[model samples]
Target: MARLGPLLGALVKIRWRTLLGRGSAEITGEVLMLLAAGLMAERFLQYLPEFPVVWVWVGLAVCWLGMSRGPEGVPGQFPLTRGDRMVVRTVELAVNPLSWILVFVTGRISGWGLCLILLAGVEWPTWRRGKRVSARPSRWPALLRKDLRAAVRLFDTALAGVIVLMFVAYAVREANLAVEAAWIVPVVVALSNSTIALNAFGTDNGTGFDRYLLLPLTGREILWSKTVSLVVLVGGQLGLVALAASWRLGWEMGLVVGVEGLSLLFLLAGWGAWVSVWVPFALKAYRFADGGSVWAGLVAFALCLGPGMAAARGDWWVRLLVLWVAGAGCWVMLGVAGRRLERGRERIRERLP
Candidate 1:
């Protein structure tokens, strides 16, 4: 046993020496990270005397980062492994003065706080594990439908009922002129329904089933399903909004806004679908190496807001016309892109490599 212990200790010492001599770059990087962390902690702690509310904000910020990042590697070519991240965070918690200071200032000794601290510092093992793409190409439609059902099921029934009641209460309180009040419902509906278009593809983070690729459904079929789903979702929201507007704005104003809002819903939903398809194509075409497509989507989203805002402000006829035109344009673009994708499937697959 003593002989085995000496051998194990020697191995450990050798490994440590090897890691220590890996490179000056690694050492520099560690130094920079420690310095930056220290500066941030100092700044946060210094502000506590003047701003008591800042602690919660800091906690929230830390929690958000921990939740979102969860143990990913550093942003470089030689990114830290998940285990490395865990070790680093553990060391920081033990040795860093700021960790103690943060604990002291926050007074968060509960299990949740410990969880957050661990999450903030621990390297999640799932990160950077090359994703396994299922090579099945025959079951995309069922897969998408499953996700669609899941999306619908995910909404809280009680929360939605509460939202409805709140809308009614607000309408009753705010209604003065029926025409003006009627517009509010449709606008709310349009905006809320627009959430259905969130980056469905990106949500999977490359690990989840590539449902579209697995199914025999063409891009057109997928687009159609998405469009239909959006129409139903938007229509439901529009109906609710129209009811609310009618309560506050008069029947005529409600009708006008309802129609306009429905049109806007179609336009926004269509555009969102179109962007989703186009983004993947653009990423493939440009051969963007990282998360550049997310940035591109953000830019597109920002640009789309202009038409939405304009349509929201006008009378029923004007809003309807604007939304109709916008919707038509988006539909046309989607059709063109869908056709292009369908025709260029082989080329796209080739580009992916």
Candidate 2:
């Protein structure tokens, strides 16, 4: 206690105004935690016969529909105008029907449910903020790193909770068969890991991510660091899932699952990290002047869904080899393109006029 006296005294000497702000922040945090707990507890109740999973899904659907019908005048356009309204609506649009359907049919929501929540909270906030923050000519690496770190911190608690819940569910219910469970690790990793890099690269203003060309760092290096950070985080999570699933199955299956998970994680992270560069270009075809809109995102999403589903369902080895080749090609092409574009006069129009 004596050793803590100075520290306590120093803390007390801090501004009261800062303390008040922090106190409010703490209260907000507690409220959010309580809300999440209540939601999850409601979900847990679905285990009882009186509370069918189907009914739970119906309730979720209702909540989503309620939220989607926002303030009377709010435009339901590509990019929502209001943050709170957008948050409420987008979460409903993204999660409700599909996730509810999945949970109702399968009795459990896949990692995709977690991904949806993340998209609503983190990716949506970035888009909403980016709309207001004009493109200042800045280095891409610094911006990318800042965004990545901010996003990780933003979604950390929500993600950790969802993963823990998944772990508990898998452990207690033995819901997944040993073989299918082994597959789940790789499938979930492959399915979910790419969005981080993808969203990071895509979530900028009308200037697009191309302004990175003006930076001192080579595009390859910028891409490399982003890919590395994304891969490490996703790979680490995949590894943990493998470790857990391994305890259920034998070591052999465990090792195989782990390798599969890593392969998928790296493959998608690399591909997504690279293709993220083309987002601005691809998006140009859909909507050039309306920058950072969720409607544009929805279209890009639809374009990706077929390919993503194909890749996810294909033979693991074949898909892995194909993705490896595609990723290598993208890496080389993106470098060449970055250098050419960086040095040359490529007049890319702003997405927002």
Q: Candidate 2's error at 141, in angstroms?
A: 11
lDDT of 2 by residue, 136-212 (tens): 66445455555554334323222333443454345445644346545543453333334454544433433544555
- The residue-level lDDT of candidate 1 at 117 comes to 52
Off by over 4 Å in 2: 1-147, 153-165, 172-177, 204-214, 281-353
Over 1-353, each residue of candidate 1 has an lDDT whose tens digit, in order, gives 23334433544454356446636764564355335434434433333343433433344334323332222233223345555444544543344333444555455434356545544543343443576855556444545554454334322211222233344544554535335334443443343333345333433333332445566766766666666665665566667756777666668656665566566666666666665555542211101112325554454455345444554576556666676776787678567756765765554443232
lDDT of 1 at 285: 12
Error of 2 at 264 (Å): 1.7
What lDDT would each prediction earn against the true structure?
Answer: 0.47, 0.45
Which residue pairs overlap in candidate 2's backbone? 289-351
Residue 264 in candidate 1, Cα distance off native in Å: 2.1
